[model samples]
Target: MSTETSVTPSLDRAMCAELDAADPLASFRDRFALPEGVIYLDGNSLGALPKDTAAHVQRVITEEWGDGLIRSWNDAGWFAKPVALGDRLAPLIGAAPGEVVLGDSTSASLFQTAVAAVRLRPGRRVVVSERGNFPTDLYMLEAVQELLGGGEPLERRLIHDDGPTLDDVLDDDVAVVVLTHVDYRTGRMRDLAEVTRQVQAVGALMLWDLCHSVGAVPVDLNAAGADFAIGCTYKYLNGGPGAPSFIWVAERHHAAARPALTGWHGHARPFDFELGYAPAEGITRFRVGTPQLLSVAALEASLDIWSEVDLDAIREKSLRLTELFISLVDARLAPWGIGVASPRQSARRGSQVALRVDDGFAVMQALIERGVIGDFRAPDLMRFGFAPLYVSHTDVWDAVANLEDILSTEVWREARFARRGAVT
Candidate 1:
């Protein structure tokens, strides 16, 4: 039997083959070590391993940790990885050399940025954010506010729509407007440039959560006049799980913003052991604790791959992959109540598509058993992420074919597929 189906003309196997042939990023698939029989479509949540990562990790463990020991901080350049990696990543996100710093988790970075932003705009206690933002961003702000005080004493405003206007909430009383550049659930992208301008008009600082935007989208933090931003490397950047996250403070704010969680490493002169709390110059001041060596090593290995490719090319191929997934899935699964929840327009969507289906969890389980790995969110949303670096147009076609087979044969309707797990 042929792996062919009659659907939208653009979604056919022939069209996918043509797209694969024309793809500039086609060769990049070999750079990753994906399983032989699996079509991995969850790169938005956790990226697949790069082929070079294992060897790099082994060298770090054997040479740096075993042989160099404490001296590795100087000889192997271990102490400077945060700043050095930040410099390497700056170009990918359109930032300057001293603007970005790598450390901690996305939650920690958000808290640091939020605290600095509120402090910068003293007497203005309000933090404006969207209701649909990632839960961690909202929770972190709430925790920060509670630690400072109680009740509505520290105002927290939540926006509810995707419209162009935010001027209503961007008032003088608002100290910071914390926003995620790309909506995590719906995959809807916001206008970063316009939003930055609006927030600045009210004399309020903007702290962007680039967790979904950073490697997948073209972000010009400096050009957009953005004040602060934070993101994780495990997603589109392909850093391994639990890898350290990154934060960016514009060159102007580097000297002004003060980090709350100051540590010995962030001291101006660590060996001097000064009693007073003097911060290091520029972005170095934001480094609050000792860096995670193993995780940082993994992230550096991933960054090596990122340095070779152009982000614009990555964005182009990402859009093509998502478009193909949507076009194919809609034709095959719409009859079963699977509706597209992500933005249809390429410009307004990120690198993923969320399909709304009544039995999303079961459908996803069935697909997983068939070697097509995607994930499901709450309240009927099947999320598929297309990482252009390792995912190909042919992989998209195979994933959709597996979905069609599962739905047509009633394989997903089995009661055994409904068991809930700790993590999705």
Candidate 2:
């Protein structure tokens, strides 16, 4: 038997077609409900809807909710949906069953896990996180600091590319370190196992925010020996808007882990009508309250598709797509001062690439108008996410081609594009 190897193909549209024809996951593209003529490059922000999502939600509404009503909590297994879905999601991130459970939003999950992680290490008063982390994570951490702090908030230390490296900030006083596995804006990935080792060596717990890495890149939380993790289902997971987040606690941590929220769902004997709260065993202790069942239904449908996916294959295709897009941008768009903002090395990059360009907000607006949809970050970064399940080599070529045409024509300077939306 021979091992197949990947080779870089020349820059050509016909070559892209050849690559697509040979793609093992090409058939999976039809499973998504993308609009006609729209090359979606924003799966990192919000995933395209799965074709089965609507029917699945509809069945849950008409049969489970409408017909079954209250009986559905048990008969339809609605009560167990969060833990059950977490078990299904475990494999994608190298987690074990009973070690992961769904939570509210990513912010809420971070607060839940961060508080518990801090409590695990008493006497340590400092929390470490990246300056580049998603704003919500930092925001939630602020609340954690105040709530846990005795009159004074816990000191927060930020590590950045420019100064005060992780080594500089690590000390005996650090309680927990929360960092995103893959940076949300620049698409840079961290060495999970290595960072875990570094944090643990200094007597600090490492909690990962895997929002961008879970479905797009290869992650092995247990293998990395991480203490805690939380990620959302709405992005590459394609669970639809406002889907729930999930939290993973190492089996070893369950015995001593104390979640901040003591909602009835986490109570060991909820139906007993006890006045006091006693958390349930294992991952169930992290649950705050009743889950959004309809949203969980949508996630359930998406997980069905994920059950058959190969993470290694997804990683391979992701690198291919990102590499292709970067190459095209460098070759064609560099004349307009557009440069790749993400790491050039595939090992250090995730499934998305960020491009640095002038007037990026307007340029992204123009790109969206032309149907090559990506997104813009605050100062000057245009992010393009390549979901291997749907985005193809041809899509990469077309996106760059569209971007080039927009830059050359100066259409991005138009008044309509300059108008900013509340979300962006």
- The best candidate in terms of TM-score: 2
Where is model 2 more than 4 Å wrong at Cα?
1-10
Model 1 lDDT tens row, 121-240: 888878889988899999999976765444555788888886434766768888889999988887889989998998999899999999888789889999999999999999988889
- What's the lDDT for residue 221 in model 2? 91
Q: Model 2: which residue pairs collide?
A: none
lDDT of 2 by residue, 29-61 (tens): 999999999999999999999999999999999
| Backbone steric clashes in candidate 1, count | 0
> What value does the lDDT take at residue 233 in candidate 1?
92
Note each model's CA RMSD in angstroms: 3.5, 2.1
TM-score of each: 0.95, 0.98
Candidate 1 runs further than 4 Å off:
1-10, 149-153, 162-165
Residue 257 shift from truth in candidate 2, angstroms? 0.6
